[model samples]
Target: MSIEFYEEYIESNKAIIYKICRAYTHSKLEFDDYFQEVCLQLWKSKEAYNHQSKLSTWVYRVTLNTCLSIIKSEKREVDTVEINESFDHHSDLEDTEAQERLNTLYMGIRQLKKADRAIIVLYLEDKSYQEIAEIIGISMSNVGVKINRIKQQLKDSIVWKSLI
Candidate 1:
């Protein structure tokens, strides 16, 4: 792909990349690094995209693979970081509550195994089972099974946290 096409592709999929990076990284610095690395990897592998799957699918696969590899190389356990440490004091109560819920969910997600984390993130992003299977290289039925199990785990985690 030409530079122009690649730039357009990145623009279109930037949110997906950002969400994946945030799901994998603990700090803004790590998120920035992973985002850059994912973009670079996409550019380097541009020619290898054989049009066999949707561009979004390819992007998800690449971003997830890149993040997983980075975590593996670092050999450090993934830890949860407060997504936005400086809360906006002027925000509405409802908005603050929503943000807190999201942060709690993300913290739970971060504690999951790398593969489960990827699956749940994709599911949350509204990717269909087929799309998730394509990105994750799992059978569609397996996607359903994993998602159900992951949901239960997250639910259990949240419930356990509430009891503490």
Candidate 2:
């Protein structure tokens, strides 16, 4: 596809890219790095898409594979980066607290196995279990079970936030 067409796709899909990037990122740089890797992989794998599945399914499959490769190759553990006050642009002070909670939530999500993490991301993005299963090549029941477990795990992790 031409650059213009790809650019349009990127714009339309920015939310998916950004949220998935956040789910896997350890730092701001890692966000950009993984996103670029996903874009590259998408372009490279474009020829491999068989058209049997939807375009969104193909993108999710490619993105998840790229993220899993990064996770395994880096062997990186879950760690939140130090908050850079300079990057703080919240309009209301109350919103900063919400941001912290969201950051922690994502960090907890990041601790999950890659498969679990993918399910959680798709779940939080309000994707149906059928869609998630189709994209990840899993049974719908598996996706349903995993999302419930991931939600419980996340709730369990929130007990110690006052200490942080």
Candidate 3:
């Protein structure tokens, strides 16, 4: 693909790329690095894309695979910092509350096994079971089952954290 097309493609899919990167990395530095790596991988594999799947679906697969590989190679445990500490103290009550909820959810997501994290993030992005199965290489029925189980796991984690 031409450089222009690649740039446009990345821009169009930036949101999903950032979301996947954030799901994998806790710190901003790590997020930036992971995002770069995902983009690089996408560019390198551009010629290999055979149009068997939608461009978005191909991007999802590449992003998830790149993140999973990076985490596996590094073998570093995610840091367990207080989620609120990363937020601004001056935000109003409503904004703070919303940020806290989002942070809590992300914290819960980070605690999951990598594969489960990928599944949940895609599900949260409103991907259909068929699309998720296509991206994750699982059966459609299996995606539904895994999604239900992952939802319960996240709920339990959030509730358990609140009790602490």
Q: Per-model C-alpha lDDT, please?
A: 0.81, 0.73, 0.82
| Model 1 residue pairs with clashes | none
Candidate 2 worst ten-residue window by lDDT: 82-91
The sequence of per-residue lDDT tens digits that candidate 1 reaches over residues 15-126 is 7887788778766677779988998899998888988988888889899999988988988776543334322222234676787777677777877888999999999999
lDDT by residue for model 2 (1-164), tens = 57774874455666677677767766767777888898888877777988897776677778878887887898865444333322212123367777776777776766676677788888887889999989888899988888888888878765654466
Predicted structure 3: lDDT = 0.82
Which wins on lDDT, candidate 1 or candidate 3?
Answer: 3
Candidate number of the best lDDT:
3
Compose the digit string of candidate 3's lDDT tens values, residues 1-164.
46786666688888778778887887777887898899889989888899988988989999999998898889866534444434222223477678888778888888787888889999999999999998998999999999999999989989999999
TM-scores for every predicted model: 0.85, 0.81, 0.86
Cα lDDT for residue 147, model 1?
99
Error of 3 at 138 (Å): 0.8
Candidate 2: global Cα-lDDT?
0.73
Residue 78 error, candidate 3, Å: 4.7
In candidate 2, list every pair of residues with a backbone clash.
none
Better of 2 and 3 by TM-score: 3
